[model samples]
Target: MLLIAVAMTAILLLAAGVVAYVAFPHRGQRMPVVPWLGHAMGKAVNAMPTGTAPQDFYEPQETSAR
Candidate 1:
């Protein structure tokens, strides 16, 4: 009984390790948000510092007297 129990425990541990390894390929990659949304957001955000946007993107507010 003791040997059988030990063998079962070792088998379980090996199975758990194999499952962890095989499932690891899908572990950490960030899933893109809404298909091409990731690429679009990255381009727009990255362009801000490089000043690649059109001039009409910003507008001035009119001053008013109280």
Candidate 2:
């Protein structure tokens, strides 16, 4: 029936998508610039109103002397 054909097509498409997603080469944990990105984000955050203040953001435990 047409309904069965439509269901089979949907299932096939879903399986193919899953396979493609799993087989693709990705950047997870393998990026060389990850550390630099972290440092940049940290600096950006610590720098101002555009991000977050390093001191007040993590306060209560408070380190003395700026």
Candidate 3:
């Protein structure tokens, strides 16, 4: 019984880790405001600061209000 309980606990922890990795790909550095919304948010948030795409698309003044 104890063995089965430990195995189940380990399985649950592993599952949680996998889910976390999938949800936040960048070592959990960024967290989305909405659950499972990382895919949408990451496009802008995950871009490199030195990259052209983010600079071209990001609005500096609009975001400053927040």
**Which candidate achieves the best TM-score against the true structure?**
3
Taking all chains together, each candidate's TM-score versus the true structure is 0.37, 0.38, 0.41
Model 1 lDDT-worst window of ten: 24-33
CA displacement after TM-score superposition, residue 35 of candidate 1 (Å): 28
Question: Which tens-of-lDDT digit does each residue in 1-66 have in candidate 2?
Answer: 999999999999989745543343122332243455444544554675765468666557757997
* Candidate achieving higher TM-score, 1 or 2: 2
After superposition, the stretches of candidate 3 with alpha carbons farther than 4 Å from their true spots are 26-66
lDDT of 3 by residue, 1-66 (tens): 999999999999989756765767545555555545555545655574754566656565555564
RMSD of each: 17.5, 13.4, 14.1
Question: What tens-digit string does per-residue lDDT give for candidate 1 at 4-47?
Answer: 99999999998975554344423432334343544444455457
Ten contiguous residues with the weakest lDDT in model 2: 24-33
lDDT (C-alpha, whole model) for all candidates: 0.57, 0.55, 0.64
Model 2 residue 23 CA deviation in Å: 0.2
lDDT at 44, model 1: 58
Q: Residue 4 error for model 2, in Å?
A: 0.2
